[model samples]
Target: MNDKANNIKRQIAITRRDELGHPPLHLDNNSRLCLNCNRAINDEINIIEADPACLRLNVLTQSASQTCVICNAQEDIGRLTIHCRVNVFIEVNIYIPDNVRSCEHHLDENGMFHNRLLPGLRFINRPYLIKGPQLQLFLQHLRNVSANKVKGIDDKNLTEDEFKCIAPVSKQQFEELFTYCDPVYYNGKLRQIKRKDLLMFLCKMRQGLSDDFLKIIFDYHSRQTVSSVAACVRTSLLERFVPTNIGLQSITRENFIEQHVTEFANELYNPRPAEPKVIAVIDSTYAYVHKSKSFRVLRQSYCFHKNRHLLKPTLIVAPDGFILMICGPYFSDAGNNDANIIREEFERDANTLREWFQNQDIVLVDRGYRDAVPLLQHLGIDHRMPAFLQRGHRQLSTEDGNESRIITKNRWVVEARNGHLKSVFKFLGQTMNLQHAQNLSGFYRIAGAILNRYHPLINMQDVNAEFARQMLQRSTVPNAIQARVEVDNLRLRNGQWRRLYGEDVPDFPLLDLGYLKDLTMGIYQINLAPSYIQDKLIRENDKELQLDEHINEPGFLRIRLFSRFRNVVKHQIFIAYTANEMENIDNNADNNPISGYYCTCQSGARSLGTCAHVASVLWYLGFARHQPNIKYPDTSLLDTTLDAAYRQPADIAQNINVDVIDIN
Candidate 1:
């Protein structure tokens, strides 16, 4: 009877659970649904059972979605929904803990939030997580953006300032050059480097920077890489850029005459009726070099003029400073003098200079090219060089002096142009290293090309041709006063003149600085005259002056001044002055002076204009002397004579023909 009662109790419990519409606690593996709501659970949601027989579903989902079905069912059935087994996964791994006790939360190391919690779930701190593939894609996108911002050589994205730092030419000009040197390849690989970058590298090299320094600045991997790239680019530039920009073929003879030949050059150089068709100024410039290991090379590279090892290159430029051609980085030995190098350029079968040059083409040169004069004459070329000083004469004759000055005035452009090349490209200024010494010709050629393409005209504008013409005409005139004084032996006639010093001549004329500049034709000599005067004053206290009362006309005074080039050497300068008589003369007037002037200095003897020595005397007498207690800025007091003596030990000086004089 008791067993029958227990069986009835178990049956009643089963029947009550069935009447409540509850399903079995365990289901097949294919079933994934909440027991309370009989709804499908999301695969992403987590489900947890409280016990094997009683299912306690913990559905974890995003907060943006509706609450889990189990929670809704529990709420509808009038049970507490707060204890329902469901968790929302909103704001996961979003906020990090603040160890500094600040009011705000901070981002994690990966720039993301940490310690994210769901609405019904417990708060937890964890590492910020991102899918591997998503993170990789995002990083790659950032890399692409950064690369796009960085401009390559060929790109037109660089600013003008940035572009100019690399290349002397403009972007448009570089593009044109790019088309010419476009197909540069190295080691069978198409050059990935941009033309602009290559050009910038070349310019940096020319600027005299070390390969190591360039590598750091340019983001190159190694110094070797920078050197290699620079070499390749330089080779390309020499092959294409130099031929088109620098060579003789670049400009036709007609164009050269019409555009480049200045009117000042024509007037000054072509004064005679038998003038040549073209006037070219020629000179040799030296590049310093290291002492070679080989005895033959060391002997060959020694330059007596520079007192060092050097390479000499002949530069032939137009009178306007346009470089026409460059010939040979000839060895600086005795046999390879400037004259010989120039002769080779003309006579050598390999050279085109002889074929291109026509008869009667005037070439202006300095005294260094005197040996080449006969060769030039043989080729029917008229070469004009400065006259040499006579051995016994204190100064050149007035005619010879005047002729020399004319040649110098026109030939100065070539010297200035050579200076410009050295100034712009510092690589040329410094002694080239052994590695680059082998390719000196190529370097020189490239430098010439760069200057021709980018540098400004050496003579910025044509000089006043009319003024030049008048000067040229006046240079031919003989100084009557100078001739008379010499013929009459006026300097020796001491009784005919009163001796005067700076202190005795208080009536010295007053003149303006502008007047001095006009007299000298340029400020360089005038600016230098004060230093020369200061040097003379500091070194020699008792400067002598003699006034010739016999030759004194109404407004003229003849004075003899003692001048010295060095301590042991003394010379006399004869001055014929016509005092300014106009009471209200403007200070700016060019003729405001002791108007008529001449000196015994080589250049002053020329009727072309006054020399620095003559200008200095005139300035001192007219302006500087009249200023009471005026002070001049002290210049370098380094006595080169003492410096040289100090460099040598005592006994060696006696063996060398060194004549020691007491400077004190």
Candidate 2:
């Protein structure tokens, strides 16, 4: 009889324009004992009913309806009824997702409410204009609807089918599942999605590249924000994925020995080598740091080591054909010597280090690491750095010298690893700073984690194959040993080339030197070593004496011209060299007959220059003359620029040095 009476029209009350200034809270059912924030309003309960709770009824005949009431709400006598009853009240716990957080609502026992903003409107309805992420807004709306407990609408209650949204789950259930996580307090960041939804998505993908796929869920975000967030997450999640001591502490020596070492060794030997088997190699690379702002004031002096331009980090690595160790990057203040870095890395004690050695652990370090030999022995590490006679190391025996060359020839692995590490993170070379220190350390740890995901350059099969090949070559043809003998014989026939020219070379071909040219150039940036490395061996009872120090040992060792060609044969330097590296040709001498070929120094292999030694060796074999074809540079031929009259411009020469220089 009263089905039409089921159509409940909420009472609307319109106040006069003069009475529109009161707070809407005064129109509530009972302001004297109201705790609206913590109290829920539900209409049409089984015992009672609720509607028009969230909405304040306002009836207007001729004037605009306003929401205002007197202190005595029941006595106001407005043209509307402010109904507050329970229609669908149900006591239940909430189950909020981890990503969804709840706000704290406060209402005093005396029915008064106050907060930084409004009591119940915990967060501002900012209405994120964000495109793809309307999910947050959807959740917010559900909360608003649930707080008021409005009656449900079925298919017949709505006019349009498409407008019919699904029924919202109970809000209490969601809240029970997740504790509110205040993102502001957590960090100055916001959660873009509900925790439950995010976890669900992650679980669904179940792959290593979950972050890449996260873009789809947040496509509505601004492109710039999205990209930045993605990048930050990439770096951040790297820590999450890989347990490192800096972040989650996940690295140890066991992993290095079992996983990384085996992986690297395999790769080195699996592939065929061009010549003799490369057992091990050693090299050093420099890591740089930021400038010191206080240096000028505190130090009151500018030293290259501590100067603001750059700091130094030197690394000793095993870079042979196989698995290499990131041995020691002796980190220090700027303006430190390379040799000193080596001493630090080896712990300054010879006998103490011998315990860390594995079988066949040949160290291919630079001559700067000479002091580390005694320490290397302690660990059973074979130290095979090249002989820099001028720097006062004992002269190499014919056999020892050749062995050094062989080790160096295969020592390019350090350079490659150094290149990969520094290049991937250029900021490591920028001026060191407080925050940067943390970042750099994190960078190294996170990078290792990323590397683990991908396959290493080495593998077990590869190691086995390479090991087999090396064994075959050593038994069958002995490439390095034989080459060394031949080179020594050549030098013997030619006599010593060191003192033959005995001239300080000021102007060598800058273009001819390749790799070393660049390294030297960089060292020159901080004034490391810029000039030619001169050398001559003096023999006393078959022992050798250097200008700086003499090591008289019982062996067939003699100090002759430390020929520039020495390095090129097996110690192929990848850069240009100064005249000191060659025959030291005099600028005004008329006695010496100059060679007409490229420099025999390793520098020639790196750049376009030829020192006196290279020139002499090539001339003896007649390779300096121009030869047609084979343009990569003939260690055997020389193409003269004699056809042109003008010399290289000063700017070009200056520019060349800069191009090659890199600071340690």
Candidate 3:
């Protein structure tokens, strides 16, 4: 077998050399004018080879004079003029003269013009002859180029960062993925295109670069060839790679449960303590596409909610952020909401999803899948969704709010999974061409499969397990502080308000990062904390408004914050804390000092997680004040960069004036 492989390799090499039209080795000792130095060309002289094909094809070339060929500069620019090699001979079977010269700017970082035809190169008519060392140099250049072209994006050339940035995978992960492509067959030949083509395809997906750009990057001859290679790789991966990593058939239902099921999901959504159910979070993400020429397609892809032309793909992810399945990049038309799309999946029974779903299995979804709740029930699949407000209701009840928080806490992983897909495979983040509409589904599915197969789980830490337990413990707890504030009519009636600053609230509970995370139940609210506090400080400094304090009850503090919305409403936040009267008590401790908290906002009264308003105050008193020189992002520049448009008095009066004129 080894002897046969050697013979095959030898034959392939000989065939390539023959196809290159390389002349057989012959002795030629004739001295000629060198293209590089304008001197005699011999075995001892190093003559530069210019693109001679430019002369035959009438393409652009620089003068044979001493000045830089590209710029035609008369005066010396203090830059070295390089004598480029005969890439033209490799290109169009034409020999470049030795007298041509070009500046360093035209050359790439490798000091060679990478396969591209340089504009300033001087081409000559005569056939360039070389002997001994010159001929050996030419052959060596050809060999090096061939080797580099074959090597492509292998581990030897690129660092770990470069590999990950280009292919979004480590060298180790790339090697494993290459195993599937190494045995790839094309036209009845095994390993026909090699793993280099696989790297090209992955680089395209990760960078979202143009075919032309990718051709230049990967050293391909044409954009058409690049497209062909990508197509071949896509087909190969879809057949052999995607099926093993993603979709319902990738792993058994039991195996998926055992591997990807999270403690948080189990504790939050599992109704039966005896039986462990498959907890999956379902969500839909959109990929924006350019407007199509066909009106029907334009209408089909237009999404009214987003006010954009896009396609929607439904992502089903496990609680541990493992992508279970990706379904339909269906039209973003009015008819295809998350509910409709999911219903279609069940109706069509795509990938045996119906069979995969067990009776007691739980699916955590947002309000977008509310309409599909009845269908989930009919299919014997348990689904949990956030609570929806009635038409007249201003806020969710404490019970409803807490339940919604629990559902959302588990459902957030699907969103993270979607974000991961977009971040790693940047192709999905941008507005894709309408020409690729047919391949959009394949692109997302392939990306999903790659992420599932190679990437680490989003929430795999032991700390998450502890956080989950805390969330479960607080799931049924009601907001007692919220009830007390409502009963006492604290919001309705005005009290003698005192201005509250960080220094004034010394008795307030001090919070650390971990405690803040526990209070919010997620980093999202904590992230918004600094910005909210900054806004409050700016408002206080401007004398427009301040955080007004109303403290009638001991160890209970009340402060009102302006709503983040455009409305002129403010939410009254109440925090019940133990006063730090003892001098020996640890002020910076991460213990539960702020015993109870509540706000009157829509989802604020939840015991499971505090609202952003309450979180902001707590973050300021406990965290932000403790840290010195906490510089928030300068958002004031946004106001200075552009002015908000104000309606002209004439424009506003135009409609009324027209009405008056018609009446007259």
User: lDDT values of the candidates?
Assistant: 0.61, 0.32, 0.70
Best first by lDDT, ranked: 3, 1, 2
lDDT of 2 at 469: 42
Flag clash pairs in model 1: 94-113, 94-114, 95-114
lDDT of 1 by residue, 1-664 (tens): 1245334333433443464456744333443323522222211122212222332222222221222212332122221111111111223422211111111112212122222312333222212233477446545645654565353343366687777666656667777766655434565543433454466565664577787777666656578777767766777777778888776777877677777777777766665533436778899999899988999999999988778999988899987788888888899988998788888887773356775666877899888788888889998888898888899886777788878877877788889878877876777888888788888788888778878887777663325577677767777878776776678776577665655565555545556666665566555566555555654554443343334445354334554333545555434455654455543346555664444556666665766666777776766666665554434443324432356444322232122222222111
lDDT (Cα, tens digit) per residue for candidate 3, span 1-664: 1255344333433443454466643323342223542332221122223433322222223534576655666554223222245465665554444455555544533344533344334443322345568667777878876777663446558888888888978888878887776334444433233456778888888988999988777777688878777776777778878899998889898898788886656766786644678989999999999998999999999999999999999999998888988999899998999999999999898458888997878898889888899999998998888899978999998888888888877688888888988899888898999767789878988898888878888864434556667777787787888888788887776664565655666676556667677678777787776566655555444322245566565566677677767547877887888765443335356656888988888988888888888888887776666555455545545444655664122221221111111100
Error of 2 at 111 (Å): 29
Instruction: Return the number of clashes found in candidate 1.
Output: 3
Strongest candidate by TM-score = 3
Candidate 2 has its poorest 10 consecutive residues by lDDT at 81-90
On lDDT, the candidate that comes out on top is 3
- The segments of candidate 2 whose C-alpha lies over 4 angstroms from its true place after superposition are 1-284, 296-308, 314-362, 390-398, 429-438, 455-664
lDDT accuracy of residue 140 in candidate 2: 61
Model 3 local distance difference test score: 0.70
**Model 3 spans with C-alpha error above 4 angstroms:** 1-155, 182-191, 460-470, 540-545, 581-592, 645-664
lDDT value, candidate 1, whole model: 0.61
